[model samples]
Target chain A: MRAYGFRVPGGFHATHTYEAVEAAERIGYPVVMKIVSPDVVHKSDLGGVRLNISTAQGVRDAFDLMMLRINQRLPDARIEGIYVEKMVSKGLEIIIGMSRDPQFGPMLMFGLGGVFVEVMKDVTFYIAPITHDEAMQMLMSTRSYKMLVGARGQQGVDLKAIATGLQRISQLSTDFPQIAELDINPFIVGEFGTDPVAADVRMALQSPED
Target chain B: MLEPLLYPKTIAVVGASKKPGKVGHEILANLIKGGFTGKIIPVNPTADQVLDLPCYKSPVDCGESIDLSLIVVPNRAVVEAVKSSIKAGAGAIVVITAGFKEIGEEGAALEREVAEICVSHGVRLLGPNCLGLINTENRMNASFGGDIPMAGGVSVISQSGALCTAILDTAAGLNLGLAKLFSIGNKADVSEVDLLRVLGRDEQTKVIVGYLEDITSGDDFIKAATEASTIKPVIILKSGTTVAGLKAASSHTGVLAGADTAYGAAFMRSGVIRAENYEDLFDFATAFAIQPLPKGDRVLIITNAGGPGTMAADAVENAGMRVMSLDRNVATALKSKLPAAASVGNPIDVLGDADPDRYLAALEAAQEDDSVDAVIVILTPQAMTRPVETARAIVVGCQKGDKTVLASFMGGRGVLPGRDALAAAGLPQYYSPERAVAALKAMHDYAAWKRRPPRIVARFRVNTRRVERIITRCLRANRRQLG
Candidate 1:
């Protein structure tokens, strides 16, 4: 996805403990670690995700624990190595996604992420390859639009960054008809002047028959 | 040119019947009664004559080149009739036969085969289950429908044949004119987009009115409508939307984006004016078909009754248009000319006893005001009012102004003649104040659409080779929608 010029979190893949330590050093302290495997679907539930690992020793230990847990729980799962990414905690979380509509081709979706997403379910959509004004309208149409606008004394996120992220996904959606569904859940959006990052992403392509 | 299809020089009525109540007989009768001057040949296997016209055994046996073929044959004979028409060099074919695609799988297969044949030959096919079409300019009533509108500027395309007849009847009753009316039933070969493409180039059509149940192809429609709307206003009354019944599976964005969003976005992008309800279609059709595009959002209400006048003002505000306070000079001019009891403000009530002269003065005042973009003349037929005279005055008032006017002649019977006259004069007159205001707002919205900046669709660089490779694999696997 980063190859598409979408802003992903500063991250690296590591196969060994020494590489994990190297990755931590390169990304700096207070990093996040994740178990990368083909079979694992519920990462947090399977103790695959670890956040805020400060030292090089912490990174190595976390990587080893993840491998051991994976080996114990799901022996057939491929040990694809661990992921080390810079932890972004301060900014707001939003979801930007795309799914091909049967009649309308690719369509974009945007809204707030996390627990409230299920509870309130405020979102909006625009058919992809959306223009700047169209992207802006999508953000404004959502129920969580106030959050993006900075309600009360709270600071608003960089909406342009988010819109840009959405526009990139839109272009991707149009460019590749094969991508059946995609999601950038919890895209951490920084302050007005700061850049938003695609913290986690998933792309689901359709089967040949479908 | 749509000459062969819409303005054909001759027609062969296939399956032309001598029976009075049959579909074939009615179509042939309608063609003759409609004053179509072109040569009309009847195709019948049995009868020597159908409604006094010489009957040929089939289209192939017609000898003279057939321009249009109206097939009113049974399901089984339609294919043969179409082949015969093609052999006779027919440019277009209107299959008025049912049982194809409307019945079941066997019918769908039959329709598909017919559609394939039409596509291969590039024949302009209207329907396998429809009332066919009518072109008023050519004075052709190829359909069995009874209502044939007066010749004018609005071109109509309907999805349902039943709705097409109903709409034509309504238009006839209201004295609305039509340049072209097509009932594109099933739209197997030629869809709404195809009609829009043709209508876009029609010099006679000023406004395009469509009743669409579903868009056959969204991208094609967008492209066609965008081109059409740039030249002439396209007003569509799109119905049959199944609201977002799909639960939010992965994200909330899925929930917010309803089933209707695609249609709404497409309309917005293409500059197609969408009428919200069933009746709003005619309201918009009347406005775009007859009146000028309003210059701005400022509206002035001139009325005989204060209550209806106030209601019109409220509707104007609700429609996101402002009711303009009278210009000082215009207000002064109105005050000096009118009675002391009358109001000279936004809802310029001329009093119930006011007649044609008063309406003429108010309409002219609003027209002359720089702040007023459009005017809505509201009337409640009072005992003292002369409806016909006032209607004539309103028509004259419209002729003198650049700004468009919408009329609300509220009530039954007493104001029916006035409404009738206004409609005949091609002035959009609604039964309610709200309807008039709605039309006014549509005018304002259309103006806004015209003024909107052209959207620039941005292109971004991606790994084309990788994308191409993936697509190649998908295609190799015989997959259109890939994972």
Candidate 2:
């Protein structure tokens, strides 16, 4: 999560369409608008996301539509605010997470992200906190490592950047023991020379118990 | 300590019975038959004597300290029996009754009571449903199981008494020796961690083989095993070692990060050989029992058949061992000595019809190859092949060694005699080339582990507070991320 020094899309939210347009202009064009709330876990599934808005008018209009649709979809749903962020167009999606296993202590997981992740789940696990070399091994051991390394004419991503991101997550969990379940989905790993960024992150805190 | 638990000076069979088929009677009989010179006392309320040993109404009435007590009373009477054993100042107790834990909530509560009693009394309890423990040093057959096991360096600690007996029978057949065998059922007080740490210090134990179903918490055990592997090999065969990489879940690493993944990491970090299956467990133990660790990673596969040799080559490579190319001189010598049909490659097949003498010539070539760290000799049942003679020749060639050698006598009826020869020579042998390669791989892995430097974990403090503040700002601004 951005709160944990993990890279995330940059943009700002505003109260009105005018403020939304102004915020989009300040952040640059091609922003994504989504309904942000404490209640909603899956915003896209609720038709609460508007993507790739290139113009200020596009950001303003999309923000209004997103809020209206979310309100109409769930009449009882409490609206927290609207989230606007710069859209990431070029990158392969990957997922990284950590879950504290009662028996095994802290465990970290890595795998390919996107829709096909469920159809063809390719993932691996390691006990936290993993070193840079081990993080690299976890990345390379996955089925998508070849794609990350640029196979079949597809462009390669900066593996070190992603490995470093994983290591940072490792450090984050180590630093914050209260985190029980963490999911950083669709960590957009850009083509060579570009830093990989975590697009979405959700963490569930561990409830205190014996 | 383990002295009273393992080499007890006086043992009491709490539920001693006159009946032949009863567990108490059988344990009493096994002790006498095992030639245990230590005093064996029987405890029973009604019986005058059991197995000709004078009986006491209870351990409390024994009027002397009991080093170890084997409690085989009924489920209802176990707690009372254990308390009396504790009252008699028993240092260790092996409860042989089974109603505890395995029978569910009430039984688990009962087991907990037993554990609490043992801890409060400062006593070590082996099991509530165990076959019992054996001390090869004292020739003590404390279990109701069969004949006294042979005394040797390997120590077996198993959670399952049935599996322990099976392994004992197998070890007996293979002429393997054991320093101790513990059927640590339900581990009420002493778990694998306690035994591993204790046995790591026991001089009689050179290798430890553990069969466990679960490992709940083992940071101390990992540290102990890591220290133990510094001097001896610890081979473990864990039941239900699930591959975390196969579990389907919402997270990408769900499968790879399952519960069992921790065990794998623990073993790797501690430098223990975790056998993939039962056969691997046996093979690895047998290799460690018979052979020395390989000097290096280079392995040479010499066989009579090309196919099996290549299969072994692939296996060796898969096991992360290299089949190094022989030196020019060694290859030339092999080329000239081997028949025209032979190949002088890494496998260095000596032709199918090659006899024991041909095997010797190749074995000699392997020994001469400076790059060859270990040799796996494969023999097929060819018409002209003399399997036993080849085995003897291979053993002879391996005798002049700094390098270790293993034999693979492939086939059933025809290779049995040769396999026996290899076994009789105290040389490790397998029925298949891959099995042989696996044994060699174990040797290589042990060597590699021994060579690994002391582990040091470098921790980096990444400042998440700055990231947290930025994220909080974004959340208030309704922005979650940016490219």
Model number with the top lDDT: 1
For each candidate, what TM-score against the reference? 0.85, 0.90
**Which stretches of candidate 1 lie above 4 Å from their native place?**
A11-94, A110-124, A137-159, A188-191, A207-209, B241-258, B304-314, B339-342, B351-354, B381-386, B460-483
Tens digits of per-residue lDDT, candidate 1, B1-483, equal 456889888899999999988999999999999999799999998999878888999888877998999999999988999999988998999999998888999999999988888779988788889988999987999999884678988899998899888888888877788899899987878789989999999988989999998888878888999899988999998887623324333323444455677677678778899999768888988888888999888889899888998899899898878988789999999898899999999799899999899999998888888899899998898899888899999999998878889998999999999998898788899999999888878778778878877677677676767766765775676543211
lDDT of 1 at B115: 85
Q: Over 4 Å off in model 2, which ranges? A: A1-4, A15-17, A48-51, A57-75, A89-92, A112-120, A149-157, A190-194, B240-256, B442-450, B464-483
Best by TM-score: 2
Restricted to chain B, the TM-score per model reads: 0.93, 0.91
Cα lDDT of model 2 by residue, B1-483, tens digit: 677888888999999989999998899999999999798999999998887778999997877888999999998899999999988889999999899999999999999999999998889999989999888889999998788898888899999999988989988877778999999999888888888888888899988999998764666767777888888899998777543433434333443365477677677667789898888878888888878788988888888888888888899898778887789888987888878888888888888789888889888888877898988888889898998899899888987766788888888999888888887777888878899888788778778778865444446555677755654554566543221
Considering only N, C-alpha and C atoms within 3 Å, which residue pairs clash in candidate 1? A205-B483, A206-B482, A206-B483
